[model samples]
Target: MGFGAMNLAPVYGRVEESEAADTLLAALDAGFTFVDTADIYGRGSSEDLIGRMLEKRRDEFVLATKFGGNQDSHGILIPGMGRPDYVRRALDASLSRLRADHVDLYYLHRLDPTTPIEETAGVLGELVEAGKIGGYGLSEVSPSTLRRAHAVHPVTALQTEYSPFQRAPEEELIPACAELGVTFVAYSPLGRGLLGGTVRTAADLEEGDWRRGNPRFQGGNLERNVSLADRVATLAAEQGVTTAQLVLAWVIDRGALPIPGTRKAANARANAAAGDLTLDASVFRRLEDIVPRDAAAGAQGNESYLANLDK
Candidate 1:
């Protein structure tokens, strides 16, 4: 398991700097050495927080941050974002905010449709050669894109949203990563808290929480999704574990590196502990039966969000 810093920012709701700092420190202390963040997460706010809070403990963690990505819009595939020159600048900017000489792993947050993936990989390879990044990865890209990018320069990881609610990656992405020796970084492995029963209704989220704007958290969709999650929750109870711990364990069992985000120290510790928890085949079978692949309701994301995925 790894740590996701997106929620450390006020992405889901208001989060104080002290709380965020504690969460980051706690996550590291709790054995989550792989920390993942993005430049666009809070538009640099998340990286800045990580930089300030964890700078002293830098050597203790493997830092990963992404660049050149934007969604929740037209999925325009900004030409400049993918250009070689901009990629260099983005790394420098990320490094500055991360307070690090080089990120252990850097990902292209959005696959640039306008530019050949090979070209982008070439620039990232240059960065690695120049000591700006240890390695480069791709996000929301197709298997073909991964192949093309890996051929140019060895791809380090492939970061995407994966969980029981979002199983599209199982079709091709997981197989390609396994074949190419790439890490399948699973973000939102807990179905963004829905599978954990953390979110029940739209009203369960804060007024400014971004999930409120998500189609999956809206009226009827929220009810249907919660019902599915409840079944999993019941099984989790019978197994004497929190719904979240069960979900996290299942994600690890699936051979993907799950990086779940939380703003609480207790939750961070619990998440890390879940990585070490063992699950039996019976539990896995029950989980699959309760929530099979593609068993989610509502739009996981909007048209713009889907456009950038598997591009």
Candidate 2:
């Protein structure tokens, strides 16, 4: 299993430093071999926390982190900054924060429109040659972009949102990755907790929570989504598993390594246990009928967020 460190960031909620460190350690103890993070997450707070907690156990896991988004003075992510110089600088900064000389996998968090993909790939290739990163991946990119980037340097993986609620990648990106022999690393396999059936309403979220602004969690969209999630919960109950476990099982069956983030040790243990819950073909068919593609109420995110995703 892979651990997503996004929840360790304050953007998700108010996570105490001690709790965050313990959470990472808990996940490691649970047999998670891969951990993914990004520089923009809490303006480097996530990486810093990982550095502090896992610096001594670095060899125990494959550490992966992303770069490319420039942050403002307030630590807000200013999207799209993938120039060659910026790429080098970003890797250096991430290495410093992670307290590691080299990361197992480095990702270009978003496609920088200002710079050519070939140029970005070339710099990452150079980094690989320089022994700074073991391999490089791309996030939220398209097949054409992957081909172009891979021409310069082979992409080890493609990170994107893939769950029962978000199946857009399956139509194109999944096939492309399979054809290119690239691993599809799925982030948010639980539909940002919706598929988990834990978030009942907007009030359930903590103050200043980022999900409050997500389209899927607002207005009529949220109401409809809750109903949809209830159906998954029902199925999970029938199978004697959690809604989150069922969702993670489905994502894994689809051939992607899912990185589900959680702050609680119980939730992490539950998520890891889902790796063994195999869904029968009949149940899988029933699941498809329950939550079909495009059944979700809103777009993956707001306009600005969706704009960054390669078409």
Residue pairs clashing in model 1 are none
- State, as a TM-score between 0 and 1, how close model 2 is to the true structure: 0.96
Model 1 scores a C-alpha lDDT of 0.88
The TM-scores of all predictions, comma-separated, are 0.96, 0.96
Runs with alpha carbons beyond 4 Å of true place in candidate 2: 71-80
Q: Model 1, which residues run further than 4 Å from truth?
A: 71-77
C-alpha lDDT score of every prediction, in listed order: 0.88, 0.89
lDDT by residue for model 1 (1-311), tens: 89999998777988898988898899999999899999988889999999988899999988999987865355455556788988888989999999999999999998776788888999999989988789999988899999999999999999999998999899999999999999999999988889866798777898689888778888888888999999998999998888899999998999999999998898999889898888797998899888887788877787667766665
For every model shown, the clashing-pair count is: 0, 0
Q: Residue 82 of model 2: what lDDT?
A: 73
User: What is the C-alpha local distance difference test score of candidate 2?
Assistant: 0.89
